[model samples]
Target chain A: MSDSRVSSVIQEWAYSSQAHTQTLNPTTTNHAGSTSQLTQMDMIPYSQSQGLVRGGTDDRVTEQMMGLSYLPYTSSSCLSNSSSTGTTNHHQGHPNTQQDFSSFLLPSLRAPVNKRSISKDSAEYRLRRERNNIAVRKSRDKARRRILLTQQRAQHLQEENQKLQMRIGQLTQELDTLKHILSQRHLHGAEEGVAGESNI
Target chain B: MSDSRVSSVIQEWAYSSQAHTQTLNPTTTNHAGSTSQLTQMDMIPYSQSQGLVRGGTDDRVTEQMMGLSYLPYTSSSCLSNSSSTGTTNHHQGHPNTQQDFSSFLLPSLRAPVNKRSISKDSAEYRLRRERNNIAVRKSRDKARRRILLTQQRAQHLQEENQKLQMRIGQLTQELDTLKHILSQRHLHGAEEGVAGESNI
Candidate 1:
């Protein structure tokens, strides 16, 4: 398959996983909750194991080449295909073409291949899921912290506003008292002048 | 008058001035906005001047001793009474008591004493009112600044919240892609395994 097709497949897988996580925790997904449209394709046991081996190896090489180090786990096929590709490469130099044919049957000759591969694929899937879950949790925690900090700052600002209002009140009261004293003195002076004039 | 009565008078003057300030700016008086019930008392001119002189000096001394440096200006009577009291004291110690008495008579002796005193009182009132107006404007400006700051901070917090929400969406999408890839590989492996079994 072309590189673009492989990347598109991986992108589809990530989208599916995000949907699964949302289904697991519906409450938290209220903000950007959207139903995943990707359907689950059923697979036969043997093809599932083989596909796991091929896709895992291909995804890992593609991710590494693309420098996507954040995706910690390689594709499921990487572990199985790497040794097989190495063996095939080594056998390519052999003159005995019949040995190479026998080598191609080696996987079938192993009685426990299906069970072992299936178990391995299951384990890898579980590990990748765990890592994705951790990343989601971390992002959520960070968002929550930011919200809390902002709320605290808003509360502090409100308190400061109230205190300033109180200060204005005190100053207003002081100014009024000063004005009253001045007016009182003026009135008193006027009255005394009138009395003095009447006596004269 | 007793020291207590003098202090009471000063206190009443302070309270009256505070009431006047409240009346001038009715909007900001959230705490003591009730109408002042303190009645204006009539007084002889000599006593009015004496009270002004005493109250002015006492209030300054009290405010200084109390460390109330924020109150920049003294009681209203201070400016007018300070000059009058100085003239009275200088005349009191003169050997020509009769001449000093004539000088005291000079204010009452003048036909325009009432008009001149009224003009002087008006000028002082105008100056005091101007100062009060400036203080009110300053207080209002400070309140406006505080309100503006709070609104800006609230806007900033909302923007931050939006950015964080966007980040969460991005992270969710990334996580979903990773899950989809893992599931796809598992399904592919199963299909290959079933095909192998059917061939066997």
Candidate 2:
């Protein structure tokens, strides 16, 4: 791929991360709680205003890649339901919201468009869409889980590290105390002089 | 936002994750270690063959988002030089090769296509491309660092955890020995029994 083109796409990613009234649906909880087509429809105009028609068949592919075209984002977004107002709630629910739009959506690849205007209504395209729908959900669920797991592992490790450091500290202190007592008695050899330390 | 459309994009993501001869550029080292428009052109036919013309001005945006548009991929792909044959090298160097093209490139959201036929040669598009190129590189570098840091932290924690466990074992053993000696003495005192169990 041309570096120039990648930059253009990333630029759109950067653009998408911003809270543009013309660009975003701006729902974290709303989208997740929303099981209706109405919620999807509500978000369409905003996505369409950005340039790609959310309703358009070709662009719908792009929408999925964005991770924004669909409703009911699980876990982080869906779990938290706050505010009737929009943009603020987006940040409130998901920490990786920018990553979802920018990093996650980074690849907005269009399969070499030899057939750019391929009939979206075609049976093959519909089949691809259905398969993709399943795949994306599975893929996203997997993605979300992996990220959460990584974060949890990191947290667990940090706590373990601190506990280890504390243990090391305790061991060193014990060794020092043993040395001090032996030194006061002018004793040599740890095995004999500090046979059991404080263990009787 | 339609589940069907999102699935379609993710299905492409799955497809992209695979080693499709026609669909992929199949370069990890080749793209990064070398630098030239010629190399970019060389990969064009493969990417072009993916049904989206790599040579097309309009489709270049999608190509960028796919994380496949550019000549040079830094770090994980660039650092290792293992294979001369194409597809093998892609997997050989980058562990997250699929993540790069699939998850990292996941967003692929297009600006709503109001002006679908935006002139590529136009100064505006050119500027956007230039800015995006810088942003993408920076963004990717940040992402790589984050993932690496997380992995490193987990490894470090595991090692620390083992060491802490060992220390706890030692401390417990010393405490047990102290108790045994105290029991042998048959002298039951509150503070004297367990005081400084292993600290001399």
Give the per-residue lDDT of model 2 (tens digit) for B1-200.
12233343344334434432222223333332323322332333322322322243332322222222232232221222212111121222233244424444434542222344334334565456445644654453444334334544555566668778888788757655654654543343323335545445
Per-candidate clashes, comma-separated = 41, 33
iRMSD of prediction 2? 22.2
Categorize the docking of model 1.
incorrect
Please report the candidate that would top TM-score against the real structure.
Answer: 2
lDDT of 2: 0.38
lDDT tens per residue, model 1, B136-172: 5445344333333333454445445556556555555
In model 1, state the lDDT of residue B185: 49
Error of model 2, residue A126, in angstroms: 3.3
- Quote the lDDT for A16 in model 2: 35
Could you tell me the TM-score of candidate 1? Answer: 0.21
User: What is candidate 2's CA lDDT for residue A61?
Assistant: 21
Give the alpha carbon lDDT tens digit for every residue of A61-153 in model 1: 111121211121211111111111111110011111112132233443322323334221244543543455445544433332333333344
For candidate 1, give the lDDT of residue B58: 21
